[model samples]
Target: MALLDADARHPITLPDGTLYRDTVYLKNVIDHPRIKVGDFSYYTHSGKPEDTAAILAPYLGHSVRERLVIGKFVQIARGSYFITSSANHPMTGFTTYPFRIFKPETFGYKDLPVRDTVVEHDVWIGHNAAIMPGVRIGTGAIVAAASVVARDVPPYAVVGGNPASLIRMRYSDDIISELLSIAWWDWSLDKIEANLDALTLGDMEALRRA
Candidate 1:
C-alpha cells in the first residue's frame, strides 16, 4: 500500500517526495516492473503503463529482454518513452512478420543484438522524447523535447530533433574535463548543500577551489 498524505490529491509519495499528484507527484504512473530506475530520478507520467507504453509495452507483452537502466539525478519529462529492442523484427527473413511468434514452441521473442539502453546520471530527457533501444545518454547531457534519440549521446551534450543530433556541448573541452572531474552529483549531500552557491550561480572557479 502507498502512504497517503493530506497535501496532494494522489498523496502517495515516494521516499524522496517523488510520485505524487496535485503538486508534481505522480506515484501511480510508475508501475513498470522491468525498468531499473536509480535514486532521485523523477518521472512525470499519469501513473498508467499504457500512457507510457513505449518503454513498458514490449516488456509487459514479453517481447523484449533488454532493460532500461536509469541513473541517479536524471530528470525525465512527461511523455518521454523508451523504445525497447524487442520491437525489432528479423529483417533477414523473407517476410517482416514473425512466424516464430505463432508457434507455441517458439513463441518467445528473440533478443536483439543490442545492448540495454542506459541513461547516465544527471541527464535531462525532455518531454515526449523517444529514446531508442541500446542508446546510451551520457551524464549531464540534455535531450530536447520531442526528440528521437537513436545514437549515443556524449557527456554534457545537448541534442535535439527526430534523430537527436548534437546541437552543442554544455561547456568547452577544458571546462567539461574539469566539470567531469568534479562530478558534483557524486558529492555528499552536506557538501552539495555547502556548495549550493557554486552550483546555482555557475561559479566554476568556486567549484574548482572546492
Candidate 2:
C-alpha cells in the first residue's frame, strides 16, 4: 500500500516503467505430481508459459516447446523473474505511443506460439535468474545467481552468467556415465536404500565385479 500511495504522489514510476502494486497470474499448469511452489515465489500477472516459449524456441528443446509440463519440484525463489513473454514496441522508428496500444504484427507476434516451463527433477536455479522462454534446464542441473539462461542446459551441469556458458562439468565423464547408467534418482526411496551400497562409493567396475 505504501508503494502504491507513493506512486500516486508523483509521476515517477519503477525502472521497468511498470506502475501499480503487484498481481499474480497462473494458467494451464498440468501434471505436476511432486511440484512445490515455495512461499516466497511470485508469479507475474498474465505470465503464460506458451507465450514465453515462443520467443525462446531458438534456444530450447522440443520438450520445452510442448507448452504443457509438470514443474516437478520447482523452486522459483524470492525476487526471481520467470517471464513467459514480453511486448516490444511497434518499431515505427518513432511509433512510441503507449506500450499496450501497438498492433500485434508490429514488433513480432503475429504468430505467437506458447510453450511450457519444464524444470526437470532435482534442478536448482539460483535467485534472481531469468529462465527465459522455452528453455529446458535438465535434471540435477544447477543455475547460478543472477544469470540470464537463454539456452537449454545439459543434465547435471552447473551454469552461471549471461547467456550462461559451461564453466565445467560436475563429474568426470566416467562418473557421469556411471550416474546415468545407474539412474537411481528416478527410483523409489526404498529401492534406493536397498541398493545404497551401489548408489554411492561403489565404482562402476565394482558393480560389474559384483
- RMSD of every prediction: 5.6, 13.4
**In candidate 2, what are the lDDT values of residues 1-210, reduced to their tens digit?**
222121121222579887423322122221232222321122322344334323222233332223423233334433455444333224454764544535654533433465555666556677778777667877657888788888888877999999888777777777767666666555555555566576467556654433
- Candidate 1: segments with Cα more than 4 A from true spot: 1-34, 48-64
How many residue pairs clash per model? 6, 4
State the lDDT of candidate 1 residue by residue for 1-210, as single tens digits: 322232233434568967555222222334555567654566666554445544333443433566677886687787787887766777776888877878998865564375788998889889999888889999889999999999999999999999999999998888888888898878766777788899879899999887
Model 1 TM-score, 2 decimals? 0.78
lDDT accuracy of residue 202 in candidate 2 = 58
RMSD of 2: 13.4
In model 2, which runs have C-alpha deviations exceeding 4 angstroms?
1-76, 85-110, 193-210
Cα lDDT, all candidates: 0.72, 0.51
C-alpha TM-score for every candidate: 0.78, 0.50
